[model samples]
Every structure is written in C-alpha cells, then in structure tokens.
Target: MTALVLSLAAVGVILAFLGWIFPAGSVREIVVGSVMVACLFANAILLLAGDGVVGWREAWWNVLLLVSAVLAVAGGGPLTTSVLALVDRGNTRAQSTQKAGEVLRGGALIGCLERAAIFASVVAGWPEGLAIVLAIKGLARYPELRSPDQPASVTPQAVAERFIIGTFTSVLWSVACAGLLLSR
Candidate 1:
C-alpha cells in the first residue's frame, strides 16, 4: 500500500511538471488524461481491495488527496489553455490575432483562479459554491460577450466561445479531480 501511494505520488509529480511545461497538445492531453484516469482507477482498486476501508491511515490518505488535488488544479488551467488554443488554431480571423496575448493572459489567469476555487470547493464539501463562482464568472464576462462595439480584432461569437469552452473545461477538470479524491 505504501508502495502504491508513493508510486502514485511520483507519477503525480511527473505529470504536474509535464502539465506545467506543455499544458496542451496531443502529448499533454494524453498524459493528463491518462493520469486522471489512473487516479480514478487507483481509488476504485483500493476500495475494492480493502472492503471499503481504503486501508491507509488518515494522514497518508489525506496527503495523497491533497497532493492530487493540487496537481489537478495546477494542471487544469494549462490544459484548458492548450485545448482552447487547439480549438482556435484554424481560426485566422482578425480576432484571433489582435490582442491575442492579452486575451490569453487574462483568460489563463481567470481559468487558474476559477479552477482553484472549484477544486477547493468540492474538496471542502461545498459543492454549491460552484454555482456562485460560475454565476459570478458569467455575469462578469457577460458584457464582453454581448458587446455590440466590435473592433475588427474582436467578435462577440469568438469571445463567447472562449468563455464557454474555457469555463467548461476548467470546471470539468476540477470536478473530475474532486471526484477522484472522493472515490476511495
């Protein structure tokens, strides 16, 4: 059991680094997806093998859950960014070019903060907080989405898609991370 715990921790560390470095793409996506799936599987295996006790002491399990939660939150933003970049890759619209850096920086920051909050909320057993966070996010970004004063570099649809896709990705990743922790 200790060996399994340590191995998962090691894998978590490596995956965290890879996520930090690559953030997105086929490689990043595959690695992140695989690690997440493994986490889920590990929890199931432990539960089944231990007859619902999970076997590990509270401290050990807590540490594992904490580390996994942090890794998932940290990786969520970059994964979202990478996926969104891929989604918009073929878009040669002026909106994709103009102020792209600014938009990306802002979006990434929001994603990081949002995912962190969502992850914490779920882990702390406050699922309702997700609604508040998402509501605030939607309200905060609504004006930009509905803005009629479009410059050549911006489009309402693009902005909306960015918000929608980014928010969904961030929230889903956080939820999956939380679910993994709860599984065992």
Candidate 2:
C-alpha cells in the first residue's frame, strides 16, 4: 500500500512538471492545479495512515522523499518563473524579453541543482549550509547582474526584483519540502 501511494506521488510530480512546461491555456492551469492539490492531499494521507519512515532504508518513504525532491528541483524553475511573471505583469514585453538571456544562461539548470542541494542538505541535517549555497549563487551571478555592458533596456532594478522573487520561491519551495520530509 505504501509503495503504491509513493508510486502515485511520483507520477503526480511528473504530471505537475509536464503541466507547467506545456501549459495550454486554462486546461494546463486546471491540470496543474488539480495535480498540486492531489499531491498535497496524498501526502497528507500518507502522513496520517502510512507506516513511519524514520530511516533512509525505509523503502516506501524513501521513494516518496526522492520523488518530492525531484519535483522540487525539476518543477521549481517553471513554478518560480510563472509566479514572478505574474508578479511583474507590468513589465513590458521588451523588458521581459530582454531579460530572457538571464534565464537561458544556465539559470534553469542551476536552479534545478540549487533546489536539489537545498533539499538534500537540509534532509542530511545541514540546513545551515544553505546560506553558503545562496552566497555562492549570488556571487556567481553578481558579475552579470551589475555588468556595465548590460543592455540599457534592462534596468538593474528589474533584474534584481526578478532574481529575488525567483530565488525566494525556489528556496522556499525546497525548504518547505525538506521540512515536510523531516516531519515524516
């Protein structure tokens, strides 16, 4: 039963990511929202009725954690970007398009790794290390962020706002997942 539940959760994560990536109007939103609710509901059920998974060797629960972490890492970019885009709805198309390079320049891949690291590190009882991770990521992006050569069309303030919103969403999601896992 636990195995079956965890398997379903894994599938849910995949569907969620697919929905986010291939959003086709309201259908995509409905699918993603439904999956999100279902995942949370299923997780709640597992926590309430399933056997406790107190150790790494607990097969079903370990799989659940693995799936959750994958979702955090993989779905995080799309989720964060979507949220940020909505928040910055006032941004002109040109301004948003101008910042596209920031996203494409390894940001997607880096975000995945960052979420994974945050989830894994916190689960491993080293949550403090997340500060270092944030520092490194900030330092790595600082050069491009404030570069004098940055196109005049892209304001540093806009870029900074985007970065803050995106990073906060990513980190917060990872931390929330890790916290949930820890509770389990």
Candidate 3:
C-alpha cells in the first residue's frame, strides 16, 4: 500500500509537469490536471484510510517524503492554473488572453519554491514556517504589485486577484500533500 501511494504520487507529479509545460487553458492541460487531481485524491484516501501497516525502514520513509515533496511542488502550477481558469471564466476574451506572467512575473518559479518550502515546513513539524514564507513572498512582490508601470493590458485588480488566488492554491496544495504523509 505504501508503494502504491508513492507510485500514485509520482505519476501525479509527472502529469503535473506535463500540464505545466503545456499551454495554459489548453485541452491537454485540463486533461492532465484532472488526472493529477484524481491521483492526489486517491493517494489521500489511501493514506487516510490506513490501508495497511507502513512499517518500512528509514530509507523507504525518506523516499516517501521525497516523492510527496516533489508532488507538492510540481503539482502546484497546474492546479493553480486550473483554479484561475475557473475563477476567470466569466471574463472577456481580452482580459482572459492576458498571460499570467505579464502581471505576476516569475510567478512560476516563486510558486515552485513556495510549495517546496511549505511542504517541507509542514512535514518537518514547523507549521509556523508557513507564515514566514508568506510574509517573505508578500514583501518581495509588494513593489511589483503596487507599481503603476505595469502593462496597460494588466490591471491592478487582475494582478491582485492572480496573486491571491495563486498563493492560496499553491499553499493549500502543499499542505494537503504534506497532510497525506503525516496521516499515515
């Protein structure tokens, strides 16, 4: 059962990477995101249900931790993109067409690092680290979020929405992945 859980997580991470590589809002992205979500949920269920004893050696536990962490970080981008698409479904074509990168530059890299930090913090029994991570991210991005020199096509509201949505999604995903491991 432990092996099954790890395999599911690894597959999800691979699908997530594919989704991240694909164009945002594309059919391939959606399909991959859906499958990744399924894998995550299934893994969570198995973990929570206590399918069997996970009496493994230290090395196996470490491998499980590594897989969970990778899934937490890699899965965040596709999950956040799916969420943003759902939230912005009612927007005009022009508004929707504006790439997220234009408004929140370097978000992808930041999100990956953020998810990794959050996952590690939670799994390592340092939940307070979440607050520190968010604080640092907010402070680092404050100038860009407030700058009036942004492209005309990108509104302040749009930037703010993207920031909030992306952060919440990324954080929640990491926490959930960590929770799966801790539940065992």
TM-score on alpha carbons, each prediction: 0.75, 0.78, 0.90
TM-score of 3: 0.90
Output the better candidate (1/3) by TM-score: 3
Clashing pairs in 3: none
**What C-alpha lDDT values do all the predictions have?**
0.67, 0.68, 0.82
RMSD of each: 3.6, 3.6, 2.0
* Residue lDDT tens for model 3, 45-133: 87767742267566867777887788899989888888778777788643552354586778889999999999989988999999999
The TM-score of predicted model 1 comes to 0.75
lDDT for model 1: 0.67
Ranked by lDDT from best down, the candidates are 3, 2, 1
Which prediction has the highest TM-score against the true structure?
3
Can you write out model 2's per-residue Cα lDDT over 110-139, one digit (the tens) per residue? 888999999888988997879988999999
Kindly indicate the candidate among 2 and 3 with the higher lDDT: 3
* Comparing 1 and 2 on TM-score, the stronger one: 2
Query: Candidate 1, residue 28: CA error in Å?
Result: 6.0
Q: Rank the candidates by TM-score, best first.
A: 3, 2, 1
